[model samples]
Target: MNRKVTIIASNGNLFDAYKVFNIAAAAGASDDEVAIFFTFDGLNLIHKDLHQHLPVPAGKKHDLERFKKANVPSIPEMLQMIQEMNVKLIACQMSMNVMNVKKEDLVDGVDVGGAATFLDFAENADVSLTF
Candidate 1:
């Protein structure tokens, strides 16, 4: 019963976060326990206010507009899916402090802790990835 732990380290785009969530769900379905740790800019991924603020890919004519029209999953929706699948979402305590984020403002069911907590989970994970 090896586990998979993934830490989202970047806040590039919504698509990236979506991809990570999809991967985690697939792994969990296969019986590998999944955990997702949000750190650095990645912290925005779990914030209700900032989740939808990610850029929608620029240039390439109408790409951003078309993508928006396709009804992409909102960050909150993705987070809900992650929760429903029993994925562990951890908020980096250091990042939260630096960003002045209050625990009360975080998405529901998120566990708050520092790097050590994430490291402990990673150590036990049979597969670990930093995104």
Candidate 2:
């Protein structure tokens, strides 16, 4: 059976990262092969340092207690878990250039490509989604 591929045209939103990685983790845990394609500011999610400690933003009175109570993994933890499960993380080449990100700036093992590379993979995927 063809495995699902989730392609996210991501912007650098901390909350959005949590949501997409949450889905990817659930799918990966289920033995469903998956990929997360990062573009736009989504590149921030793969940065070696930034992704680990994203602030929840201001004036929201964000509930850290709730987050702790729920045991939801942090972004870095989620990324690590998904990678351990063999979920593919692709960083867009163009986006990287636009954002002034060097490949070395990203965490290890992230694949780099344009749409042609990703779309080819998407063609055979059992499912596809974007964030």
Candidate 3:
């Protein structure tokens, strides 16, 4: 059976965005259908400039260093990998309007959509998660 996974990324934080893309990439690599929706603050993750520079919390400096030391891919790198893995990335149209984000502001290959579009995909999802 085809296992479908849906993830909603609602935060703009670096780690959260990384986690969402990482999970989607992993799932796609495993041959599962994977889709991610970036909503609210998470929309920033796909912004051309913003996606390149996600801030690390002051308290998490050591964690960032450790991740770097461990060779974890950067957020932008992970995003590229997700695309390479064929994971679907969606940007919420409603949130985009509220945030004044235009289609040109987002990375290439992201589908612009609304709740109904997400729901259509979610209807067949065997697993759904939000970060």
Error of 3 at 3 (Å): 1.4
lDDT for predicted candidate 1 compared with the true structure: 0.74
Per-residue lDDT tens digits of candidate 3, residues 13-65? Answer: 88888789878877888888888999999998888889888877668877877
Model 1 lDDT tens row, 45-122: 777677767655456446556656988666677678778878888898988898898878777888998888878878
Q: For model 2, what is the C-alpha lDDT against the true structure?
A: 0.83
Residue runs of model 3 more than 4 Å from their true location after superposition: none
Which model scores highest in lDDT? 3
RMSD of each: 2.6, 1.7, 1.1
Query: What local lDDT score does residue 12 receive in model 2, on the 0 to 100 scale?
Result: 70
TM-score list, all predictions = 0.81, 0.90, 0.95
Runs in model 1 with CA error above 4 Å? Answer: 64-72
Q: Is candidate 1 or candidate 3 better by lDDT?
A: 3
**What TM-score would you give candidate 3 relative to the actual structure?**
0.95
What lDDT does each candidate get? 0.74, 0.83, 0.89
Give the per-residue lDDT of model 2 (tens digit) for 4-54.
867684867677788788888888988887988889878888889888766
